[model samples]
Target: MVSSVLQWSIFMSIFSSICCLRRDYFITAEEHWWDYAPSKQNLITNDRTISDRLIQTTEYRIGSVYKKVKLKQFTDGSFRREIKPAPWMGYVGPTIKGETGDVLYVHFRNLASRPYGLHPHGVQYFKDSEGSLYMDGTSGRDKLDDTVPPGYTYTYRWSMLNTFAPTKDDENCVPVGYHPHVRSTKDIDTGVVGILLICKPGTLNPDNSRKDVDREFVLYADTVNETNSWLIDQSLNLCLNPQRCRQLFNQKNEAFITDTLMYSINGYIYGNLPDFPVYEGEKVAFYAMGLNLGLHVFGVQGQSFTFKRKRTHAVVFGIAWFQGLYMTTRNPGRWMIFCKVNYHFNRELYYRLSGMNTHCYSYCYNN
Candidate 1:
């Protein structure tokens, strides 16, 4: 049955891999030209996979650009605008010049201040003797006026998408639950850059029930100046709701248990669900938001307008059906449990549990 499932899966021409790990599955392949373009159709309907194609494409070439800069305040108190040389920005294509495609344009900006309304835009694309990767395409600032608000910093970046698709299996996406993985700088530069505004938790996208509730912690990612360019690293964790993470798994992993936690949040021993533990004896609403800029051309932010964080109000909802379980000890570690649950409001609730541990541990379970 597993073989049949694998056979029926979309075939990754650009990215291909053969599992080599015994306990955990690993797909490795030589990078190819087409691996950069991952399409929604292919991922949703085709026989091809993403990782296989990206790895295969990288064999021919690997390209990336980076820029680091400091911000300046406006004397007039309006906003600042000056495109100076970034720390570094360029393309990593084939060694041969003629072998490369047009230099993919990467633009940067900062707009994470007040909630201004803007549209979604495009992604950057580069083609060379080897192939291409689609990246950095965004819309104008969420709102396009220079009304700098207090505690707002923005960063904008751009890149290219050589192929038609938008995702590849080989791509190392920001892992959920880790903030830096999705926002901070790292060895590899992913197509995401923008300003980070230090605002009240509920200011950007707040929940009325939780608004003014300073006891909980909220973590989210947004593009600042340019539509997209994010600095991230492996050590930096990706924050994801336990329920949504479980949904990524099979049904066997979706069951719920009250005695144990389903997933970890902020590296804490808890489940990734609605109203999970934010700290000891303190549980707050947990959510996972999938932000997208929609289809773009040539990877630019002119048309950008859309951003979402799943189904919760304000497009942010809690992970309910899919869940995870984790336990910690004096020696912090993680464990996964395949469990199921009955859900209400299509959101995952919280449960507490105890486990066999020589050290003190906290747990979160859901149903």
Candidate 2:
């Protein structure tokens, strides 16, 4: 009987080793790789649902105002009406028109620092095809569509959109506010999901500056990922390219946390990239390296990182990033990087071949 028990234990050990060796290959035995691609399904809130209101009937209601402030001058001798963004918050819209339902397009700096929600004015004509519009200060990054860090050096632009229906409501839009799915509580400065635009009361044609604003700057938010199965960008690639960014998981079971790097600027969080192979209760350390545009390196002076668990599932590991000024002459500039790195799985090392987006949207924010 004792011999039989010993034999069973040995078999179990061998099975566990096999599982670890082929972890990534088998992690999705039940799901196909193409299943990770983005879906065309629109994300609408309960407020935008068919039952939310009269669907076939076009609604032309009076526009509402929450906070109205006007500024004709700035200390810098500018005729622009500029408003400062709140602490770490921002606001967009009113897309104001007078009582007649004309459209006014407005842009704000540091919108993440204000308190404006999506609001619609004028007579809105309902159509079968739906699309949504929102105010974003992060320029194109407001879409929250990319998997790369936001603080990177890139050419950025801001715009707004007024989508119709069935295609453009927030996936989680409710009566009071709308949620941009890509941003988690960790990324946002405020916990509130701001207001969403209902339809304006008319056919949505413009006359003058209001027309140009509507034509040039319709408030629009980028779509966010709806599945937990994959991230915004999940193209698997070799980590050897400095310009390539991708999501990866351990290829083995016994991996433990190894290193982390978190960098900050003026008390603002810039970036945090980690390396791993970590286990519970294990202490890992790393350096926070900063680089200027000139390629000069600066250490945090005297700071080494230690791991802390914020989630119940995965173990925290290491973080790292490169800080530098990259120069370009054109509107949309390209930055090049050189990196040589490989991965170690189950005592075997594997290198990535390339970094690619698993969805329809490539890393176009670089645009």
Candidate 3:
């Protein structure tokens, strides 16, 4: 019952923050090419999964690079200078931070070719601030917030309500995801999503950084169905056999479509995420978010973390479920962090995988 209440459960923490403040974030939806396997080689299984037929520039595959629409942050309304995200954040947008009673001002811009809007769950907003389009009995200017046209900017004001805030038993902070609702599922597949952290009083520094945590890692896992991407046509055009790729797409070929799925953690595949160092004994927190289809069992290779007073090495959740895991760095050396769902752990990035096995793409891995 407790698990079901928290839509996508956020993890454990410690606290500080006193005053209610207004936090503003300037965000833009931009189009660019994202390389899942940046190294062009599998790093998790030591490249054992690398096969000529399975990845990159082959007679059929376009490799790991794909055109995507990502939510990028800028300094302000001008949308000129871009704000860099954490090294390990991968493709996710900058984390928005605040305390209970604080108000959030999200200045969203649609710089991409298509229209987009910012819709967040677990927050309080009015009709004009609501970024999702629906028959809410609203019209004219009120509906503009539903989908900001390309080259337009919309401001969504969301309040961190006590009702939606972390429970008293919840350690320090809580997390929720914010993404576009213009096309909902299709928008997420296009790669525009970010995290929102709401904390108790005094839990965060003035800069919004956590006070007690020495290391923080936010990992979002999902099987990106390239078929749903708005850039699908563009991707097909870049394929080795454009006509064949288009045929597969038009026919809705299950085998060919499934082959384009990318099992990723922060938009990276096969242990290719950027390095985020954690020293021994440092207080570390791992926030894992799982989406789309398939159940995920997130496991830490060596150490165990505490969740809801339970000490375990893994946390399980499926679509629309998320977990907050925190652990001190104890076991040394490099370890692996991947979705422990049987074949997903083994055959996910195992390139030579043939046949019409659609389940193969439903799994993802990283180290």
User: Would you estimate the TM-scores of all the predictions?
Assistant: 0.20, 0.17, 0.87
All-Cα superposition RMSD per candidate:
24.2, 29.5, 9.3
Model 1 bad stretches (over 4 Å): 1-278, 293-367
lDDT of 3 at 75: 86
- Considering summed lDDT, which 10 consecutive residues are worst modelled in model 3? 349-358
Q: In candidate 2, which residue ranges exceed 4 Å CA deviation?
A: 1-80, 83-176, 179-182, 203-367
Model 1 has an lDDT value of 0.20
1-367, model 2: which lDDT tens digit per residue? Answer: 3443465466446434431111000000011122100121111122333211111111210001111111111212222433332211112212222212222222111222222222121123111001123343323323322222222211111112133221232211111122222233212112212222222233234331222111111111111111111221222221233122222223211110111111112111111111111222222221112111111122211112211212121121121121111111111222111111111111111111111223212322222
TM-score of 1: 0.20
- Candidate order by TM-score, decreasing, is 3, 1, 2
**Across residues 137-251, which tens digit of lDDT does each residue of candidate 1 receive?**
3223422211223244322221222332123331111112211122332111232212111111122221213332223222222111111222211101121343432332223
Q: Model 3: per-residue lDDT, tens digit, 199-219?
A: 887788877789989767787
